[model samples]
Target chain A: MSEAIKDLLKKNHMSVTDSRLQILDMFYHAPGALAHADIEKKASDKIDRVTIYRTLQTFEEKGIIHTIPTADNSVKYALCKDQCAEGHHHDNHVHFVCDKCSKTICLDDVHVPEVKLPKGFQPHQSNMVVNGFCSDCRS
Target chain B: MSEAIKDLLKKNHMSVTDSRLQILDMFYHAPGALAHADIEKKASDKIDRVTIYRTLQTFEEKGIIHTIPTADNSVKYALCKDQCAEGHHHDNHVHFVCDKCSKTICLDDVHVPEVKLPKGFQPHQSNMVVNGFCSDCRS
Candidate 1:
């Protein structure tokens, strides 16, 4: 767990702290992206929910993670990509929500396409979510 | 107003209703996009919030509109593209959240780029958001 946090910190160029490490590891080992409630439940009983919330927010601000909004409007979080440029928010990526497991998985490799905007409007990035039943669900 | 509703309904192949027409035109005349709250605020107070919520859900189900999750986690919705297919939802367009106006505008013509997904995962559609000060805001 510590190693996971260290690696994440190194990748993000963030100074490693115990709290950041714990939160970073939580996201790294998470098989699927986690919602706020889920993170609070599984997080160490010692960590306050508000602390976890703040941690998540800080991580997002630091570009260590990004959010995925599900059909149910629950927000999920996942690790950012290595290529995510510094000084920029996390690069937009695809998020997959599996119908069977109801798991939101980050398709980090998947990049959202560039879009052409109307006059006087300038576009910077994009987010894409693909919703469907997964292979396990179909089976 | 009735004709406008009729045209929107026929254009999107959705059923026309007082609430639906009001909601559609509310979005139509909106400079950018509208939250349910924005719709309520801009339109007559006669439409109940519950009704607005239900109507938005119906519109989403009908592929007439899609949602953009704001930084604050509130949803902002707008009209979809012409090719919006039934039973399928694609909001893979550029969403501009003007820092000045604080409005979310749907860039219909601007489309996100195609992404290649990882093995065992299928990519269907995506949503892209660009957050920055709009031209007006910059000015």
Candidate 2:
């Protein structure tokens, strides 16, 4: 895991700093996406809140992570698939937020369908967020 | 426009207050979804910023309007189609945001596709946001 993390930073030309590695580690083990608060908790005082936010922004801009919107309008970050590049992100999968657990997971298997827009609306990218109960939360 | 605005407020059980009326009027004439800043500017200092935010929240709760997430992570609100009720919003249509103009328009003709999630993940509601250049901006 550590070696892979180092390689990711190298690939993105980002330094293998402690904060970056720690945050990346969190994503590596995370079952789904994570919000800023979630990362802060996982960090456990190791990193400040502002630094975490900046790290998240940097990761997002580099396509290392993508943001998912919650029902309450909060943003969450999920690791991108291998296909994501610096300027482009192929995170077309469904972002499933567990209603019970409030955990957001990226369903990589389910790709967002290609929708035909009316004339004159050229589509660059699309996102789909599904709210539901996850496996653990299911009764 | 005044009568239509009054009827909308009445239908939603919202009091016909000046701020509510002004905000509703803005939506009625807006070409696309209006961001908080956009609405505030149009309010022309007649409405306080806090009051505008509350009014927006109320309108969203009543399903009078639905929020759209932009690529830049800003939230914009657009008038819900007539199908939206107090507690339910039939905003199943695709939300197309023009990258050039930064304007978001609800494409009522294009409904969000039904996606099949992996087992153990039950879906309740979903939102699709498409980023692109609108017709006017394409030229």
Candidate 3:
């Protein structure tokens, strides 16, 4: 898993620093996308707060992760699939946030459908967030 | 237009005050969702900053407006149609954010496609945001 993280960072031309490695490790084991607080809690004193924030920003810009917006205005992030690169993100799929557990997950099986805009409205890409109860929460 | 604002506020069971009225008027005339900064700039010397923020939160809870989340982590809000009332919002349609002008407009005509999640996932509501160039920017 650590090797995979290093390779991904190298592929994206990012330096394989300790902070990036630790953050990647957290995402690797997470059941779904994680909020800033979640990441901080899991980091558990190994990393500082500001560094984690900067690392998240860098990862997002590099397409290593994608932001998931929640109803409460807090943001979460999930790993990007291989299809996502520096300048292109083909990870435009539906995201599901569990109301009970507050887990934000990427529903990879479901793709965002193309919407036909009215005249003069040109679209580049889209995002869809579905709020509901996940399997674990329901059970 | 101001009278319309007062009536809408009253219909939603909110106290029709000056702050609420001015904010509603801003949304009424907005070409698309206005960020907090956009609203502040347009509010001129009429509304204070904290009041505007509180008013936005109230309006969102009352279903007078819906938030549109952008990639930059800045949120924007647009007026809801009559279909949206206090405690209910039928504005589950695609939103278009112009890359050039940063205008976030509701594509009320394009409804969000229902995605049948894998077994155990139950969906309640969804929001779709599309990013691209707007008509004005394209021209």
- Ranking the candidates on DockQ from highest down gives 3, 2, 1
How well does candidate 2 match the true structure in TM-score terms? Answer: 0.93
Candidate No. with top DockQ: 3
Models 1 onward score TM values of: 0.74, 0.93, 0.92
| Cα lDDT, model 3, residue B1 | 50
The sequence of per-residue lDDT tens digits that candidate 3 reaches over residues A48-94 is 88998999998988888888766566888899866376766678778
- Please, what are the lDDT tens digits per residue for candidate 2 over residues B1-139? 5998899889877789999988988998999999889988888647999998999999988998988855556888998887477777777888888888877898988998999888787788888889888999996
The candidate 1 chain A region of ten consecutive residues with least summed lDDT is A83-92
Q: On residues A1-24, what C-alpha lDDT tens digit does candidate 2 reach at each position?
A: 599898988988988899999999
Backbone-clash count (model 2): 0
Second chain of candidate 3: TM-score? 0.89
Clashing pairs in 1: A113-B112, A113-B113, A114-B113, A126-B128, A127-B127, A127-B128, A128-B126, A128-B127, A129-B126
Off by over 4 Å in 1: A1-22, A44-47, A69-73, A81-92, A132-139, B6-21, B69-72, B81-92, B133-139
lDDT of each residue in A22-99, candidate 1, tens digit only: 677777788889787887777674577787888787788777777776645677888776634544666556778886
Docking class of 1: acceptable
Looking at candidate 3 chain B, the ten consecutive residues that score lowest on lDDT are B81-90
When sorted by TM-score, best at the front, the candidate numbers are 2, 3, 1
